[model samples]
Target chain A: GAGVSQSPSNKVTEKGKDVELRCDPISGHTALYWYRQSLGQGLEFLIYFQGNSAPDKSGLPSDRFSAERTGGSVSTLTIQRTQQEDSAVYLCASSLWGRNTEAFFGQGTRLTVV
Target chain B: GIQVEQSPPDLILQEGANSTLRCNFSDSVNNLQWFHQNPWGQLINLFYIPSGTKQNGRLSATTVATERYSLLYISSSQTTDSGVYFCAVDHYNNNDMRFGAGTRLTVKP
Candidate 1:
């Protein structure tokens, strides 16, 4: 793909329903990241996967929010029992092996929990 | 965790006007990038300048790593330039990123 790709650009779900947002990072990128942006707010770091290391999940707001990167490429963020406060634009980004390099971002998935 | 702060929470400028936005950080960082979130909610990368300066068309950015501050300059702004400008930073040894509150820009024609 020319850029990072995210599936289901927009998702609306009832409370308590589980929703999975997928991100396919750029080919061979060594690092992947997930972020959430509330309306009119800045990006909030959710999780990060770098190579085969255990992901940095410190930013996950709650136990109900979990994300995993499989085979070091495609990643999925699952929000279990979604809440209205979970409504936001979920963003995915990938970068080269270095920490200082620029990362490419996906268009993002807008998730609305009602 | 690094603290990033952007000044001028909101900005309103007329078309053809010039403006400067600033981002100040509380800690040293290895990665500093600027992004623009358009009205449609697409975040477009504006610059990846951790240090030094770079320019793209009507937009230019300068980062003074020693001072822990960065500046974004928009020259001859257009209505289409209206959007939220964000600066993200990552610590030198950590990949965990953080973003500032951002500057909301409105360029009126």
Candidate 2:
């Protein structure tokens, strides 16, 4: 709608349980990106979706992390069998295009795996 | 893959003072952006300068693409300006944005 919106601002999950984080990009934005930030760390690239193109998942740390964008608007990141290390803030951002454009970020989802 | 490095890992300034942050990249980039991460962990876009310079209120930024570096200037800093500043870049051939470790700014009253 206005800016990027992320669901479940904060989540607490069991060590081995799977968790899903959602993102709603701004209207008509064609590029969406997912990033992870650990405490006192820089933002780490996770995945990127540009329009209808195949997603770039090169930054995904492991097979346990996967994401999907529906209709090029909303995206969901699924972390399977979450580990304690997966606990961090997941941030979503969107831009009119992937290059030469400014990206707007959401408030992020804080995931805590115990 | 491009490498981004931000200098002066930490900075502390009195309100109304001025400060400058630096970001250096390893390769040519088509997109470069500056962001401010507030206390709540929200990223606020500051500048989208791949080259040249841009200004917004009390803040301004300059990028020398030829030199593979960018500079952020904060004039008249305020307590509310306390946060972490990051600079990100996208390689000319790729869209993946790489970010610097960031410079933490603490503006004191």
Candidate 3:
């Protein structure tokens, strides 16, 4: 992929339903990140992966929010028993192996919990 | 956790005017980036400046890592530039990349 790619660009789910968001990062990139942005809010870090291991999960808001990356290439974010307050945009980004590199973002998934 | 702060929470300017946005961090960072979120909600990377300065067309950025602050300058702004600009940073040896509240700019025609 030329850039980070996210699936289900828009999702409308009922309360208590489960939703899964996917991200396919650029080729050969080693670091991946997940973030959430509420309407008119700044990006909030959710999780970060260096390869298949998530080194930072301090930002995941609650137990219902979880994410996993496989093969060090694709990642999935799963929200269980979603709530109305969960409606927001989920963004994924990828960068090179180290902390000093630049990161690129995906188009994001807009989840609307109705 | 590192605290990131952006000044002038909101600004409105006429077309062709220039503006500067500032971002301050609570700790030294290994990576700093500027992003622009357009009206349709697309986040575009503007700069990946952790130190020194860089420019592209009408936009330029400067980050003084020693001072823990960065500045983004928009020259001859246009109506198309109306959107939210964000500054994100990753602290040294930390995997979390935190963002400031952002500076929302409105360029009037």
Q: How do the candidates rank by DockQ, highest first?
A: 2, 3, 1
Residues B23-59 of candidate 1: C-alpha lDDT, one tens digit per residue:
9999889889999999988889999999999999999
- Model 1, position A106: C-alpha lDDT score: 95
Residues A10-99 of candidate 1: C-alpha lDDT, one tens digit per residue: 999999999999999999998999999998888988999999998989889999999999999999999999999999999999998738
Error of 3 at B71 (Å): 0.7
- What's candidate 3's DockQ score? 0.78
Give per-residue CA lDDT, model 3, range A62-100, as digits (tens). 999998888888999999999999999999999988488
Score chain B of candidate 2 by TM-score: 0.97
> Candidate 3, which segments miss by more than 4 Å at Cα?
none
> What DockQ does candidate 1 have relative to the true complex?
0.73
Instruction: Name the better of 1 and 2 by DockQ.
Output: 2
Tell me the docking grade of candidate 2: high
TM-scores, each model vs. reference: 0.98, 0.98, 0.97
> Candidate 2, residues A5-75: lDDT per residue as tens digits?
99999999999999999999999999999999999999999999999999999999999999999998999
Every candidate's fraction of true contacts kept comes to: 0.63, 0.87, 0.74
What's model 1's lDDT at A102? 91
Candidate 3, clashing residue pairs? none
